[model samples]
Target chain A: MAGITIESITKSFAGVTAVDNVSLTIEDGEFMVLLGPSGCGKTTLLRLIAGFDLPDSGRIAIGDRDVTDSPPGRRDIAMVFQSYALFPHLRVSDNIAFGLRMHHVGKDEVTSRVREAAELMGIEALLNRYPTQLSGGQRQRVAVARALVMRPSVILMDEPLSNLDALLRLQMRAELKHLLQDIKTTTVYVTHDQVEALSMGDRTAVMRDGAVLQCASPMEVYDRPGDIFVATFIGNPPMNIVRAVARDSVVKVEGVEVALPEASNLPAGTEVSIGIRAENIEVHTEALDGALPATVAVIEPLGSHLLLTLAVGAESIKASVRTDFAVKRGDPLWLELRQGSVRLLGSANQSGPSD
Target chain B: MSAAIRRPRRRATPQRQLAYAAAGLITAFMLFPLYLIAVAALQPRTAVFDYPRALYPSPFSIESMAFFLNATGILPALGRSLVIGVMTVVLALALGCPAGYAVARYRFAGRDLVQLLIVSVRAFPILILAIPLAVTFINWNLYDSVLSVALVHTVMALPLTILLAASVFLRVPSELEEAAMSMGTSRFGAVWRIVLPLSRQGLGAAALFAFVLSWNEVFAAAVLTVRNPTLPAQIVGALGQSPLPFRFAGGLALTLPALVFIFFMRPYLFSAFGQARS
Candidate 1:
C-alpha cells in the first residue's frame, strides 16, 4: 500500500560502517529483494527501513510521511523475522491475532480476522497448537499470518524460509510468492540465496561491502551484472572471467582470439576481461573455426547437465553442456563463445566498464 | 533359529556395581540426619534424651507436637513466619523481575558494573548485613516488626533472584519482542504479553527460592524482632533451654513448609534449573 524511499542512508556500528551512503526506492506493491552474501549490509538496510535501527544520516519515507525517527511500533509496518519468532506460549490463533489485539480491535473482529488469516495460510487445524508443537514450515506460515493480520502498508521479511529443509523451503518459497502476489503489499525481502531472489523478486538489489552494486530486474541483473562481483555472485558455478586485451572488435585471451559484439567501441590496446556464463559456452569435440581449444580439467554431473571445468591457457572456465554429451577430464575440447552472451569489463578491480 | 541368534542381556559390570554402591552410601549419609529428626520427633519425652539416642520410633506419640503447639508460642510464630515468607517473596519478585529484564535485554552505561554489584552482594555473609540492618531498623522504629525481618530476608534473597531471573529472561529470544513491536505493540506491551509468559517458570522458581530463604532464616528474624518472632527465631531462642521433644518438634515445623513447597514446585523447578525440553 505504500512505497518506501530511502535517501542517503548511512549507518555505522562501533565506528565501522555497516551501511554506507546508499539510496533506494521501493515502489508501491513491489516485491524488492535485497540479496547478497552475509555481512553485505542487506539486513542492515532492511532494519533501517523497518525503523528498528536509525540511520546515522538519512531520510526514510513511507508513502508521503517521513518515518526516519519513528519507532517500529509507530511505523505502521509488520515484519516476519528469520526465526519466525512466534510467541512460544501463545497458540497459533492468538499469535496471528496479536497485532489486531494490540491495536485494540474489537473482539469479534479479532476472532474473524484470526480465522481469515488462518484460512489464508491453510493452518486452520493448527490454530490451537503452540509454536513449539509446529514444524518449521507451519511456524513459517503462522509468522506470515501474523504479519498479514496486521494489514500494514509494508511487510519486511528476513530470510523467513531459511530455517526450513530443502523441499519445505522450496514449497514455502513458491507459496510465499503466490501469497505476496495475491496481497500485493509493498514488501522488502532479504535473502542470500540467488535463486530465491531471481524467482521471487520483482526487482533484486545486489549489495556488496555495504554498497548497492546493482538494482534491476532479475534477468537484467543476471545477464548484464554491473560489475565483476555481481557477475560472479549471481550465477550458480558463477560467470567465468578471463583476462584479455581488446583491439578493435577482437579480444585476445592467452593468444586465443574471441570476437566481441558488433557494437564494440572500446579503444585499441585496451586491457579488458571477458565474462561468460556457464550456459553460454558451446563445447565441440573437434577443433572448429572461431573456437578456443582447451583441455577439460574436471566434469561435474548435475543430473540434466554437466559442468565442465576447462583449462584455457592459464585460466580455468566452466561450461554447462548437455548430460548426454560424451566428456571426460584431461580430454581435448574446443569451446566457442555464444554471441550476445559475453560482457566486457575494463579492469578486474573496476566495478563496471569504463563506458 | 531367530531366537537362537538373539543377543543375551548384559549384566551389570563391576564398575556399574561399584558406582551403585557409592551412590547408596552417599544417599544414606545424606538421609541419616533426616531420619534421626523424624525418630526424635516421634519418641516419648522420656526416650528423647536417652544416651544412645532412640534410633527407632517407639511408644510413638504426638505429645511433643501437642506440647510444642500449646505450651510455647510456636503456633503464632509459625503464622508469622508464613506471613513474612509470603511478603518477602512478593517483594523480591516485584522488584527483581524488572531489574532482571533490564539487565538481560538492554545495553546501557555501567551495565556490567550493575551486574557486578548485584553479584558481589552474595560474596559476603548475610549476618554482616543483618546486624547493621537491625541497628537501622531500631533507629527508624521498624525494630521488633515482622516487616523488618521480611525486609532483611528480601535483601538476602534479592541478589540471587535477580541473577536467576536475568538468565531466564535471556533464554526467551529478544526477536519475539521485536516482532511484536513491529506488529504495533509498544515495547512494554510486547514484554508483558510475550517475555513474561515465556519466563513464567523462571519467575516461579525465583519466588519459591525467596520464600524458602525467608522461611528458614533465623539470624535476621532473631536480631530484628522480639515480639513477632518467626518460627526459626522462636526455635533458635528456645534451642538450649527447651527439652529435646520440643526442640525436635520445632525443627520439624521449621523444615516442613520448605519440603512441601519443593514438592508443589517440582515442574517449575525443573525449568528453572534449565532442564525443560525446548
Candidate 2:
C-alpha cells in the first residue's frame, strides 16, 4: 500500500557492523530485492525495514511516517520468514487471520478475508489442517497467505523460498512474483540466490560487505555490472575477469587488443579489469579476423549448449557455445570479445572497482 | 523412508535381543516391590504371617483395605494431600514459567550464574530446608496448614520444574514469536498466543513433576503440619511396628495415588499421539 524510504542506515551487533551506512528507496508497488552472499547485510537491512531491528543511525519512513524508532507491531509491515514460521497450533484459517485479529479487525471480516487469502493461495482445502499436516510447499503458501491477508503498507521477505526443494523453489518463484505484482504493494525481498533475484525482482540491489554495489534492473545487473564484485557475483559459472590496460581508445587484454565501449573514459596506463559473460564470448572453430587463438581445456555438454573452458595463453575463461559447436579438450579455437558485451570493470591496479 | 518399513529388518538381532532383556530386567526390578505389596495387602490377617509367603494372593481378602479405608484420619488426610498437590502445581507453574521463559529467551548479564543458582537450590538437603521452613512458617503463623505444606513443596520442586519449563520454551523457535510480532502483535501478545500454547506439553510435565513431588513429600509435610499433614506424613506414624497387613496396605495407599497421577500425566510426559503439541 505504501513505499518505504531508508536513509543512511547503519546497524552493528557486538561491535561488528552488519548494515553499514546505506541508503535505498523502494518506490510504491516496486518489488525490490536485496541480493548478496551470506553476511552481506541483505537480511539485516530487511530486518531494519520490518522494524525487527533498529539501525544505529538512520531514518526509515513507511509511506510518510518515520518508523525508525517504532516497534514491529506499530510499523504496519508484514514479513514471510525463510522457515515459514506459521503458528503450528493454529489451523490454516487461524494462521491467516492472526494478523487481522492482532489489528482488532471484526470477526466476520477476519473470516471472509482469511477465506479470500486461502483461495488466492490455492489452499482452501488446507484451511482446516494444522501446519504440521502440510507439505513444505503447502506451508510456504500458507506463510505467504498469512502475510498478504494483512494487506499492510509494506511486505518483507527474507529468503522465503530457500527451504523448498529446487523444483518447488522454481515454481514458487513465478507464483510469488505474480502474487506480489497483483497485490501491487511495495515489497522488499532478501535472498542470496542470484537466480531468484534475477527472476523475481523488479529492481535488484547487489550488495556486499554491508553496502550496495549496484541497484539496477535484472538485465542491467546482468549485462552491465557496476563493479568487479557485481560482475563476478551475479553470474552462474561467473563472469570472466581478465587484467587489461587502457592506453588511448583501446584496452589491451593479455597482450591482445580488445575494444571496449568505455575504453576512452579510463586514464592512460591504468590497469583495468574487463568482465565478459560466458555466453557473450563468440567461439569459432577456424581462425578469423580480430580473434584470439585458444585451446579448449574442458568441455561440459549441457544438452542445449557446450560450456567450454578455453585456455588463452596462461589465462583460462569459460564460454557457453551452441550445442552444435563441435570441439573437444585440447582442440584449437578462436574467441572474439565483442565491444558491446565486454564490460569495463573496476581499475585492477590501485583503487578497488570503481563504484 | 517410512520407519515401519525400516523397522522390520532390524528386529530380533543380537543387540536388539540384549536390549530387550536389559529393559525387561529393569521393569521387573522396579515392579517387584509393588507386586509384593499387592500380594500382602490382599492376604487375610491370619494368612499375612505365613513363613512361605504367596507370590500372588490366593483367596484374596479385602480386610486390610477395609480397615485402612475405615481409619478415621485417612480420608481427610488424603483429601488434604490432593489439595496440596493441586495447589503446588498451580503455584509452581505461575511462579516458575516466567523465570524459565526469561532464562530461555533473554541474554542478560549473569544469566548462566542465575540458572546455576536456580538449579543449585536443590543441592541444599531437604531436611536442612525443611527445619528452617518450619521455623519460618511458625513465625509467619502459617504452620500446620495445607497452604504451609504446599508452599514448602513448591520450594522443593521449583528448580526442576523451572529447568523443565526452560527446556520446553527453548524448543519453540523464537522465529515463530518474531513472525507473530511482525504480523502486528506485541511481544506480550505473541508469547500469550503462540509461546504458551506451543509449550503446554512441556509446561504440563513441569506441573506434573511439582504435583508428584508435593504428593510424595513426607519430611516437609511432617515438619510443617501437625493437624493438617499430607497423606504421606499422616501414615508414617502407623508404618513402624504396625501389623504386616497394615504396612503393606499403607504402602499401597501411598503408591496408588502416584500411579494414578502418572497414568493421567502419561500423554503429557511423552509426545502427544505422533507429533508434538502444546
Candidate 3:
C-alpha cells in the first residue's frame, strides 16, 4: 500500500495530447477513480501512473520512489486490463502464478499464493481450466485473481467491469468494493461511467478533454461542482443552468424576479446563470408566492418515483416527484426553487461561485 | 416436424440443385489426380503402364512400393530429404519468429520498409533466387551438401513464415503482454511465457509450411546439390532413365510423407487459417 502522486503529467501522440498537464495525489489506500467520457484521457492517466506509458514531461512518484521513467514491471504495480487478457494457453492457476514465476518465487510459495488468490476470487474450482473454457464473468474473476496474486503495492484497473453484462457488472462492482476495502490496497480505477465512480470511489476525479475538471468526494462533486463542466457532467440528470441576470441583490431568471439573500453582493445588471438540481425544484398545482407558473410537459413514472419535466416560460426543467402524486402530462403547474437552491454562475471567463 | 423438413426440399429450386452439383463436380475434379497416383502406386510393374491407365489397379499389390523402397540409394535420399526439411523448418522459425515479433511490436525507423520488403519477396519466384545461390554454393564448396539445400530452402520459406507468424502475433491482443508486464514480468519474459504459448498453433502451422516447402523443392536441390539430393531431386533424376513403375512408385513415396504431416496437422491448420481470416 503506497500513495501515488502525479505532477504536471502530459502525454501526446502525433501532436495530439492524450493527457495534458494533469496533477493529482492519491493518498495511501484510497480508492481513487478517474471518471470521464470515452477518449477523455482517464485510461491514459491510469496507464501513466502504472508506467505503461511515460509522460512527455512530468514526475510521478509512488511512496518515496520516483517511477516516472521506470518500466511497468519495475514500478511494483499490477493492472487488470479491460479485456481481462488472461493467457489462453495457461490454466487459471498458471495465470495467477505468472507474475510470481517471472519474479522467481519458489514453487511452494507460488502454489500457495495462486491458491489463496483463486480462493479469494471464489474461483478455486476453476484453477485447472483454461481461459477459453471460462465465461465472461469467470474470466474477469481470473483476471482479477492474476493481478491480486502479484501483491503489488498499487493495483490499477482500466474499465475492468465493462465487458460483463449489466447485472454481473453490478455484482462485480460490489464485490470489487468489498475486496478492496478488506485488503486496504491503494487502487486507481479508470472508467467512463460516472455511476461507477460515484458509487465505488473514495474520491472521484472528473475529467474532460484530457484535463481534470474536479477531484473530490462524490458528495462534494455532486453538491459543489467547481465549474460548469463539472456541474453538467457529474450528476445523473445533471444540474440545470438557465440564463439569468444578477444585479442589486436580485437575480432575474428570464422575466421573473428572484430575491437574493440579504448581504448578497453583485453589481447592477450583471449577466450570470442560475444552476439548480432536479431534487431542489418543488412542484405545486396553484400559483403561489415565490413560485413560477409552468406546465407539466411529461411525467415519467419510475416505479417508486416520478420525474415531471416542466416548461416555465421558454425554459424547461425536471423535478423529481413522488410516484403517487397524481400528476400527468399537459397539466398546469407552478414550481418554486427551494431556498438557496439557485446557484449564480458568473460570466464564462469568471469562475463559478463556490458552494 | 416432418413438414418443416420437407419445406426445405420443396424450396430446392433448379438453380440451387445446379449449384450443388457444380460444387460436387469441382471437388471431384480436384481430387482425381491424387486418386490416379494412389492407384498407379499400388499396381504391379506391368499393370502400371497398361493402356487407358487403369481406373482401379488389377491385381493390386505393394510390389512397386517394395521395389522403390529397396532401390539402390533411394532410402538414403529419402532420409536426406527428411533431415533437410526438418533443418530448414528449424532455421526459418528461429530467424523468422523474432523478426516477425519485431515487425509486429516495435516502431523502428525502417519498419514499414522492412515489412514491405518481406511482402514483396513473395511476388518474385523462388527459382530466380535459388539459381544464383546455387552458383554461390558451388563457389563456397557447399554444393552437394544438406546445408546448401537447407540454406536455400530457408530463404524460400522465411518471408511467408515471417508474415504468417507476424499476423498470428498481431492477433494475440497486445493487452495480454501489457498485463503480464504490469504483473512484474519484463517485456521479453512476458513474450516468452505468454505470447509464445498462445501462438503455438500458429508457429506449428508456419513450421509445417516451411517443412513441406523444403521437402518438396526439386529446383534448388537439383541445381545446388547432387550426392545428398533431397527425395524430389532423386526422383526427378531417376525419371530420366527409370521406367514407369519407378516414376509412379517414387512419386507416390515422396507425396505420402507430406500427406501424413498434413493429416496430423489438419485440425490446427483449419483453426490457424480461420484465425487468419478473422
Which residue pairs collide, candidate 2?
Answer: none
The candidates' interface RMSDs, in order, read 7.9, 3.9, 6.3
* Model 1 RMSD vs true structure: 5.0
Segments of candidate 1 deviating more than 4 angstroms = A248-250, A262-267, A286-289, A350-355, B1-24, B51-56
Question: Predictions ranked by TM-score, top down?
Answer: 2, 1, 3
| Better candidate number, 1 or 2, judged by lDDT | 1
- A246-341 per-residue lDDT for model 2 (tens digits): 877678876788877753777788888888999989998899877878999999988889899999987789999999887788999989986578
- Model 1, span A247-296: residue lDDT tens: 88888887778887754677777788789898999889999988889999
Which numbered prediction scores highest in DockQ against the true structure?
A: 2
What 10-residue stretch in candidate 2 chain A is worst by lDDT?
A: A346-355
Looking at model 3, residue A121 earns an lDDT score of 97
Q: Could you tell me how far off, in angstroms, the CA of residue B271 lies in candidate 2 after the best superposition? A: 4.4
Q: What's the best-to-worst order under lDDT?
A: 1, 2, 3
Clashing pairs in 1: none
Error of 3 at A30 (Å): 0.9
**B1-278 in candidate 1: lDDT tens per residue?**
00122345778999979999999999999778877887888778888878887778887887887888885678999999999999999999988988998999888999999999998887888788888888999999999998998888888899989998899999988898888888888889888998888888888899889999999888889888888889888888988898878988777777778989988976677778887434
In model 3, the Cα lDDT at residue A192 comes to 78
Reference-based lDDT, residue B168, model 1: 95
Inter-residue clash pairs, candidate 3:
none
